[model samples]
Target chain A: MKKTVNQKAWFMVLPVLLLVAFSAVIPLMTVVNYSVQDTFGNNEFFWVGLEWFEEIIQSERMHDALIRQILFSSIILIIEIPLGIFIALHMPKKNSLWTSLCLVLIALPLLIPWNVVGTIWQIFSRIDIGLLGYSLDAIGVDYNYTQNAVDAWITIIIMDVWHWTSLVVLLCYAGLQSIPDAYYQAAKIDQASRWNTFRYIELPKMKGVLLIAILLRFMDSFMIYTEPFVVTGGGPGNATTFLSIDLVKMAIGQFDLGPAAAFSLIYFLVILLISWVFYTAMIHTDEENQS
Target chain B: MRISRSNWIMILYILFLMLPIYWLVNMSLKSNQEILDGFSLWPQAITFDNYMTIFTDSSWYMGYVNSIIYVVINTIISLTVALPAAYAFSRYRFMGDKHLFFWLLSNRMAPPAVFALPFFQLYSSVGLFDTHIAVALAHTLFNVPLAVWILEGFMRGVPKEIDETAYIDGYGFFRFFGKIFVPLIASGIGVTAFFCFMFSWVELLLSRTLTAVDAKSIAATMTRTVSASGVDWGVLAAAGVLTIIPGALVIYFVRNHIAKGFALGRV
Candidate 1:
């Protein structure tokens, strides 16, 4: 059906436009301001062009963080994507009661705040007070996030999986459910094998949602701060300090606004670039689906 | 014709997915003394002390209020603005319309860290720091875009004929939208609101950065507990468990839509 248009609809949208400009555009300009200038109280400012950016680019601190951030996000995507699809496939789609139960189980961790996830694990893994920690200790293994960097990293990563795999499961499940019965009937009549049925029919349909799940997981995992901060305090000697933790320390802990702001823009650009890539691919896939 | 090797792989995956969350509910039910004692397959003395603390304490209840207030505000602000903007984007192809939508999403792309200092500075400079409004506005930076995008999708799904049908019947655009468009996309609004609420509720970065003292959020307060004179494990666990209730309830109610055609609704 054809719909009529109204160009005057611009008036209806003016408020949101103005609000976004005020909320997003203006503060971003302030970040731009801090990135290039040195200020020594009383509103005094001195120009320092590209110095902060250059230092950030060369520093081992940033280099290490970039590697860790990339590794963490990559590891999560690799594990969660296929695993999420697997879980979605197993999920009961026909029964509403069972569907709700599965959803509740999957969403269990997403509701907990990052700090609480940290707290839960912090207590749950201690030999004295945490069940898993005590259990592992009883089995004659030394496990402590406070002392071992690898242990800390693993705990943080696992905690994130517990929290977010549900999202992927939910999205993948949605995609799987969209398959009409006709498709299955056709496959049955053709005597197609299960693998062939999924590869040709289900996988194609689920790709759109899988793409969104991957993108969302990437963005969220990249920006994750509160959990690691709470669990390790970016600690066991800076082993778990991602860019967000470093950015926070620089801005709040060290009062290094110029460098922090510059770092922030760099951080924003990295995420922006990655998301733009993912967003482009998702949209392209979406267009392909439509065609 | 048969359950393949892939089916076994799926069973293992679901079991892996369920374990940690199972561990949490298990941990929550254990008594503090039992938690400290040792690992057992089940809690030796299951107790309600943790859940009980949340119900009794004003602090825990206050967390609920603060989370609720800010979340509700953010949802309202997001929907109010995004609804009309989405209408514009779906109905009219204006100059920079594509850029505008991308710009909204680009706001989401920027890390909270990049904007943390500026948000704090901007809010403090205007004497709005540590207030609920600061958090609401900060959240809107991301939520508004999401709202617009999701709403636009839903609006697109509703063919434009409905708008014309109402318009030709002497209902102007405002009345048409008021009487027609909004009602049609009610579920879209609900889903968007659920997301807005979820994101705003679970968000710790900007919320912590923005508020202190009277407006200090639950997540911020929980972090402060580490430095408090003594650790109260039961109370902390209770608060943690309590915080999960709202989101759990939300997911439970919205689980049906979890598999619904949000492709046409998610922004």
Candidate 2:
């Protein structure tokens, strides 16, 4: 697909550019402005000149939030990527009533409002009323997300896995669907075992889609706010407070605009750098496929 | 005939997915007293008072109306801009095209928390605060990029020869795009719209920040259930159940294209 060098394409893209810039650029500039300046009540302002950045960099709370966020994201990627791929593999390969049914049922969790997801799990994990809690208590296992830090962590993680693993399955399923019969036929002719066939035939084909899946999961998990906020309220003494939650606590809860702004910039940079790495890898794989 | 290993695994996984939702629905059907008095796998006595409250109360039902309003506006705006931009990216290699595409994605990477305060201030200053359009416009920051990415992939799959053929047939550019090109890529449009609607519908942070009362989303409304009243479990569960209905309807219509959308569009 050779594309022509047409400068006129600029005209076509102008509308999107304007709309995005109006939405993205203006607010971004405001964040930058707040990051550099200090303000008191009644809108009085003073030149801060990196003081907020320095203070935030030195803050223990910021350090803890960053560590917790990174740990949460890594754990999610570790668990979800393999689980998603496994689920995708086990999914029925042919389109049937059963397959469509599974697809819809599996995707139901994703379409639920984030707050509702949090609320449902909050009720479902409550010791007094939640089935999980009541059952666990009946079995003599202690399970209370509100009271125990480890329990809260486990609940949030499982909730996330339950909420998001379907995305991975769907993406991998799509990747699997794109593989033509020729590849599997060749594998059968060679008398390949399941593991060997998967390794040599399916893995390479899914590389691009898998990368996209991993990146999407990473970014979404990294910025997760609403569900955790609703469920735990970042409680049990800030144990579950990730970066976004911490930023909100700072900006909206306490009105620490300057430090929150600085924190936001740093958070944005970290996501940007990682996403760029994944994006470049995806493009490289695509170009290799073409060549 | 016996079940295969794969069938069992899928059965278990689907059960896992449905358990929490089943729990929500179960709670929604129970009276708040029943919900709190004891733990029961099945409701001891079913009640629809929660649903009745939401339907009969203006504050509760208006939240749904507001959420739908902004989500619809955002979807339309995202698609309108993205269609042409996607065509440009797919059909021609213009200067800075690659850079531009990546820049749009970078906006997607920016955490909503980063923009919440600024969005609040910006919208407030422009007198757009508490309005449906504010949330709709702000959502495009992410949805537009995604819509463009998905639409561009679908458009590229259409052969370049179609444009040439349409031109030789004496069809003008806008006329041809509306009549011929759009119809060819209708599924792409469907997939893109679904993504936009899904993101806008579920998003809470910016929507919560940008609007106060007039356009407050249902997600924000649900948060108020947890205040001094000590969590109205039944009403909250009912609201949660109701929020899922629209999304379920959308997925039913787009079930066939969802997997393909993930593969072809940005995941």
TM-score of the second chain, each candidate in turn, equals 0.89, 0.98
Each model's lDDT: 0.80, 0.91
- Docking category of candidate 1: medium
Give the DockQ of candidate 1.
Answer: 0.52
TM-score of each: 0.93, 0.98
Q: Show pairs that collide, candidate 2.
A: none
| List of clashing residue pairs for candidate 1 | B149-B267, B150-B267
Stretches of candidate 1 off by over 4 Å are A1-9, B1-34, B37-57, B228-230, B261-267
Lowest summed lDDT over 10 consecutive residues: which window, candidate 2 chain A?
A282-291
TM-score of candidate 2 versus the correct structure, residues matched by position = 0.98
- Which one wins on DockQ? 2
